[model samples]
Each structure stands twice: as C-alpha cells, then as structure tokens.
Target chain A: MITITGLQKRFGKLAVLRGIDLNIAPGKVTAIVGPNGSGKTTLIKTLLGLVRPDSGTISLAGVSLNGDPSYREMIGYMPQAGKFPENLTVSEVLRLVKDVRRHSGPLDEALFEQFQLAESLNKPIRTLSGGTRQKLSATIAFLFRPEILILDEPTAGLDPVASAQLKDKICRERDGGRTVILTSHIMSEIEALSDILVFLQDGKVFYNGTLAAMIHSSGETRLERAIARLMEGGDAA
Target chain B: MNTTTVRIIKFEFSDVLRSKWVLIYGLFFFLLTETLFRFGGTSARVMLSLSNVVLIIVPLICIVYGTIYLYNAREFMELMLAQPLRRRSLFGGLYSGLVIPLNLSFLVGVGLPFLLHGVERTAHLQAFSMLLLAGVFLTLIFIALAFLISTAYEDKMKGLGIAILSWLLFSVAYDGVMLSLIYRFSDYPLEKAVIALTLLNPVDLARTLLLMQLDIAALMGYTGAVFELFFGSIMGAAISLAALSLWVICPMWLGLRQFRRKDF
Candidate 1:
C-alpha cells in the first residue's frame, strides 16, 4: 500500500496539487480520473518522484519517500506519449533498461510475447508506429513484474485489439495481487478495469470510492455521466 | 560513478558511435589538419595557424553541438527520469557520455595528422601537446557553458541562440572589446590590468598560454608584451589553466543544480 498525507505542489504561481490525502491499496487497480489540468498527472508524478511537492509525506509499503531512491525499484512507470532516443533499436533500448535495473528474477516476457515485440526488436524507435510504441511502453512497464504499476493514458493510441489485450493484462496483474494506478479519459476503460475511482477537481479530490458506488450515488448508470455530474458540482461523496 | 550511471554512459556512448556524426566530426578535423600541414609551410608555423583555427572552432562546435544534443535528448532524459535512477547519476552519465566521446574524437582527429607529419622533436611535441591541451580545455569549458544554457532555457531556439551568442562573445567579440580597451587606456600602467582582463575570457587565457609557449607575444603587440611579462612565467601558466578549468566547472555545477530541480 501507498499512503500520502497533506501533499501539496505548486509550479511557480500555479498550484497543481492542494493538500491531497489518500491511501492507494495494494492488490487492486486505482484509476485517477479528472479533466485536463486537474492535477491527476502532477499527483502521479509526485509519487514517481519526478516532481517534488511543496509539503507532503508519501510512504510506499511503510517506507518514506525520502531522497533515497531504492523504493522506486518496486514501481513500474509508463509515461504518457513515451518518447525514446530515436536512433536506438528496440532491443538496444530494452538492454539499456535491463542493464540499469542491474537485478533480475526470471524475466517476465508474457506481455513481450503477447505484443509480438520480437518482430520489431531490430527497428529503431523512430521507425515504430504510435501503437507499436504504446505496446512497447506497456511491455516494459510489465516486464519487471514490479509491485506497483503506474501507467499514464495507457490506451490512448492503441488499436481496439491491442487495447483489449492491454486491458486483459491489467486485470491479470491485478488478480495476481499487484497494485496498478492509471489515469485515463476513457470512462469505459475506467469502468472495466479500475476497482477504485479517485475523482480529482481543481487540484482537490472530489470523490474517492468504487465505480459502482460513484455511479449509484450520483444517480447515473454510466461512468461518463457520473463523472460529468461530479464535474458539474454534484456532490456524490 | 554508480553502476546505473555507468550503464547509462555505456548505452549512450554506443548510441553515439552508431550515429556517425562523431566520425564525421573527427574526419573534418583530420582533413583540416592535413590540408593545413600541406599548405601552411613549416610545422611550427602550421601549429600557430592551427592554434588560431582551434581558438575559433573548438568553442563554436562544442557549445553548439552540446546545446543541440542536450535539447534533442530532453525526451530521452524524461524517459530516464521515471526510472529508478538518481538525478545526480543521470547528470553524470549524460555529461560523461558526451564529454568522453567528443574528447576522443578531437584527440584522434587532430593528433593523427601531426603524428603522420612526424612532429618527433621533443620541443615541437611539447608545443603540440600544449596546443592540444588548450583545445581540450576550450572544449571542456564551452560544453559546460552549453549545458548551462541548455538546461536554463526551455525553447530550443533560445538555447541555441544563447549558445551561438556566447561563442561569439568569447571568440570574436571579446578580442575587439579588449583591443579597444587597451588602446583607449594605452597611457595608463595597464599591463597588470590587461593580464587580469585576459584571464576573464577563457579563449584569451588559452591563447595567451599558447602564445607564451610559442614565445611569439610580438604578434599581439603591446598587450601581448603585458601577457608575456606576467603570464610568461610557469606559475602564470598554471593559474590560467586553473581559471580555464573553473570556467568548465562553474557552469556545469550551475547547470546540474538547475537540472536537479527542473520539472519534466
């Protein structure tokens, strides 16, 4: 489990996160959903230590997020619109990450094989299509079998078949008892995969609970309508 | 320094090798040096001509290339940031990756021609070594400046523009300004002042060191005498080198501080 308290962050004069307090449970999928500029990405990046918060305490599995970076070993992060060194071939890039990892159990090639990544292994990253790059991102995120997976807009550019395959992978990972956190605009993807919905608004948490509860409490059957109601200032907490 | 940093450097170096730009850069130097040796008469005279060329070229190329490379690698840096990597390690890796390959290309590109031309005399070899040493220092100093500009500016063109402007300030404009100052204040006891001022511009520091070694301060006229009188000593030479190294370190340290705090 990951615990966060009084988390606050500001970029210059603009505050992106405001006193966020939450617990992200393990063995479940949590989807942070919000409109653009609603602090979803900032909160995620703070957890990843990509952004430093103004005030906060974040502990992963009871270990504080201090300057020491070893805790990140258990987390896998897939950036939104992942970009890589253009000239490096796919396999070389993989090798670089593996070398940086410096430790390995039996390799998790399940997603790698499922994505048919071997066929594209020799091609440089610049040559890969958007979907191919997305597939590669997903492959790497799951490759280490990390305890927590943080994926940003994972299904944005994927084809329907690839999207379904990724959704299946997310479910299987969650079933196998790893914590998964993701942010997406697609309500159906949220409804289908996530166990808990953390709705963000104006840099604050508007609602945090299950999708079914959000839908039922907001008097809307659809996740999209429920979120829309929340955005329109309907309190469903 | 750590294993992760080493791995990053290793991959980055291999990737740079495959790009072929460094090879081309080395080739350019080899051709330039060879052509100069062919046309520029005696070896000593050729070294002097090469010194002038090195003063203008090294800073220009290192600053511009380093800036563009850093800007281009921003996405790659972002990718690395999300990994289980320290910013310090990442910075070290990125820095050494470029610095090592670039310095090697420079050494081999410029060194091969002189070796082939048989600069075997010890004095000639020592002077050649000083020239090469100066080039390396200028490269180190300017690349650090480039890193500062690259990290400080978000826009590519702004970073690039500042990079070119800095090269111009150091290489071309600085001399014009200094010469004018010396002429305007020619009446004053300005030898010490000139020495102090020259130390401020890394290019001038490097040039003065080379000229002092060549014992050809006459080419610089009055101000050159001031330089020869002061920086002509062994201690002065060491001081100039230390200043040049500071030029390299200060900017890199500043750039690293910014990089550590910068948001992706």
Candidate 2:
C-alpha cells in the first residue's frame, strides 16, 4: 500500500499538487484519469521519489520515502514515453535492468512471453517500432514482480491487440494481489481495467471510487458521462 | 560502497567495454602512441619522451572516453536511478568503472613496451607512478566535470561543448594565461604567483610533475621553479594532491546535488 499526505508540489508559483491526500491500496488497479497538465505525471514522479514535493509525506508499505530511497525496491515504473539508448539490443537492455535489480527473485518470463518479445529480443531498441518499444517498456516494468507498478500511458503506442494483451496482464497482476497504478485518457481502457477511478481535475482528486459506484451514483451507464457529471459536480463526494 | 552500487559499477563497466566506440578510441590512442614512438628519434632521451606522449594520450583517453561513457549510459542511468541504488553510489561506481579499465589499459599499453625495451628499474618505477597518477587524476577530474556538464544541459551537444571548453581551459588555455601573467610579472616575485597558477590546472600540474620526474625541467627554463615548488618538496606534493582532490570532489558533489533536484 502507498499513502500520500499533504502533498504540495510547485514549480515556481504554479502549484501542481495542492495538498492532495490519497491512499493506494495493495492488490488493486487504481487509474488516475485526467487530461494533460492535470498533475498526474508529477504525482507519479513524486511518488517514485524522482521529484521532490514541496511539502508532503509519501510512504510505501508503511515506510516513508521522503529523502530515503529504500522504497524504490518494491516499486517498478514505466514512463509515458519510454526513452532508451538506441544502440542497446532488447536483450542487453533487459540484462542491464536485471543487473540493477540484484536481490529480486527470478525474472518474470511470463510477462515477456505474454508480450511476445522473445522473437525480437536481439534487435536494437532504436529499430523497434513505437508499439514494440512500449511493449519492451511494459515488459521491463513487470519483469521483477515488484510490489507496486506505476505505468504511465502504458497503451499509448500499442496496437489494439497488444494493448488488450497488456490490459489483461495488468488485470492478472492485480488479481494476484499486486498494486498497480496507471493513467490513460482512453475511456474504454479505464472502463475495462480500473478497479477504482481517480478523477483528477485542476490538480485535485475530484472523485475516487469503483466504476460501479461512480456510474450508479452519477445516474449514467457510460463511464465518460459519469466522469463529466463528476467534473460538473465537485471534489470526491 | 554498497553491494548494489558495486554491482551497478560492474555492469556499467561491462557495458562500457562492449562499446565499439570505446574500443575504437582506445585502439586509436594506442596506435597514436606507437606512431609517435616509431617515426620520432631513436635516442634514449626520445625514448624517455614516450612518457610525454603517454601523458598527453592518458588525459585525452580519460576525457573523451569518460564523456562518451556518461552520455551513452544516460538510459541505463535513469533505469538505475529508479532502482534501490543510491545516487552517490551510482555516480561513484561510474567514476570507478571508467578509471580502472582505462588506467589498466594505459599502463599495459605504454608501460609494457617501455619495460620490454629493458629500461632501468628505477626509471620504470617512476614512469609507472607518473603514468598511473596522470591517468587517475585526469580520469577523476574529467569524469566529475563531465557529470556536471551532463546534468547542466539537457542537450548532448551543449554538454559536449561544456566538456570541450573545460578541457581547453584545463589543457592549453590555462597554461597560456599563466605564461602571460608570468611575463607581465617578470619584475615582481613571480615564484609564488606561478605556484598559485599551477594549482588552477591539474592537467598542467600532472604534465610538469611527470616531465620534471624525468629531470627534463630544463625545457621550461626559469618557470621550472613552479614545477619544483609543487612536485619538489613533500609539502608541495601534499598541497598539489589536496588541490587536485578538490577538483575531483567539488564538481561531482555539485553535479549530484543538481541531479537529485532535477525534474527528470
């Protein structure tokens, strides 16, 4: 489980995360849904300790990560647009990641096979298409079976089939009692995979609950309309 | 210090070894050293001049090889940073990984041929010390400077420009400026001025130390006193080492701070 309290982050005078507080439950897929500039990425980076919040406390599994990096061991992250050195082959990249993760258990081969990365494992990362690179990033994120997986736009460049495969994998991972956090603008993806929908608007959580509760309370069958009504209304009632 | 940090260094070093560019540059450097030896004079003094050639190539190897290594490892760096590894350990590991192999290769590449030619044991020992010191100091200074530049600029070209400017300042421009100062102050007590100026550039200090070790300070005329002042006394060597150690520590400390605060 991940807990955030009084998280206030700012770049100059423009506040990105404004005293936000939330709890990310373990073994659940929590989707932070918001448009661009909604502070989703900043929130994720802060949680990962990649960015420092002006005032806040972030803890994973009851251990605070502020100014301490031990929490990174249980966390796996895949950025929105994964950038990799062009010269490294896929296998080499994996090996490099593996080298960094010394105390982790055996490699998660199931994730690799599910993504079908074996055939293209020897190819240079630069030669892989956008979809393949996303697949690679996804594979790397889940390879160590980390307790918490934070994925940013995991399906952005993936084909429909690949995206579906990844969604299924994410659901399976969550079902197996692992924490997963994802952000995507694709409504169908949110509708399909999110156990809890976190509606972020203007740097605050407007809503947080299951899709069933959101749709039932908002009096709409469509997830988009429920989100629109929630946005029309106010913060997480 | 941590095992994870050591593992990171081990893999980073392995990755650096696998680079074709690093291998190519190392080979080219070896060839250039050999060429300087083969086409030049055949006297013992010229044979000793190979030390000079070694001094020049060692620093160049340190700078170019290290700068390229950091730039090449950006992705891997990000990946590692996301892991449980400490920032200090990651940077420290990279610094060590770069220095060890290049220094070893440098020793074997130049020191081997010199020994094969049956150079005296004392001469070989001094030359070995100078070569190792030059390679180590140059590697640390440039690696620290390169880390600073890499974090200062987002673009690789800008980072490279910062690195080249730093190299130029340390390599040639600094000595030129010191000479100009020495000329203007020829009438004043210039000995201490020269001593102060020598502390500004480690590369020049290393060169003067190595050259003077071979008893070739006659090449620099009256200015050789600056070399003798630093590399001459026990006190001078201590002061020079302290100053050079600062050159390694300060920039790396600042770079790590900047990297931690960076938005990446």
Q: Please give the lDDT score for candidate 1.
A: 0.87
Model 2 chain A: lowest-lDDT 10 consecutive positions: A228-237
Q: Scoring model 1 with DockQ, what do you get? A: 0.68
Best-performing candidate as measured by lDDT: 1
TM-score for the B chain of model 1: 0.95
Taking candidate 2, what TM-score does its chain B reach relative to the real chain B? Answer: 0.85
Off by over 4 Å in 2: A11-15, A103-107, A213-221, A228-237, B39-44, B47-61, B121-124, B221-223, B229-235
Residues A84-151 of candidate 1: C-alpha lDDT, one tens digit per residue: 88888899878877777665788788878988999999999999999999988888888888999999
Q: Each candidate's chain B TM-score?
A: 0.95, 0.85
Pick out the ten consecutive residues of candidate 1 chain A with the lowest summed lDDT: A228-237
DockQ for all candidate structures vs. native: 0.68, 0.63
Interface RMSD of each: 1.2, 1.9
Residue B116 alpha-carbon offset, candidate 2, angstroms: 2.4
**TM-score leader:** 1
* Per-residue lDDT over B61-154 for candidate 1, one digit per residue giving the tens place of the 0 to 100 score: 8899889989989878877887788988999998888888888888898999998888856777877998989989988888888888988998
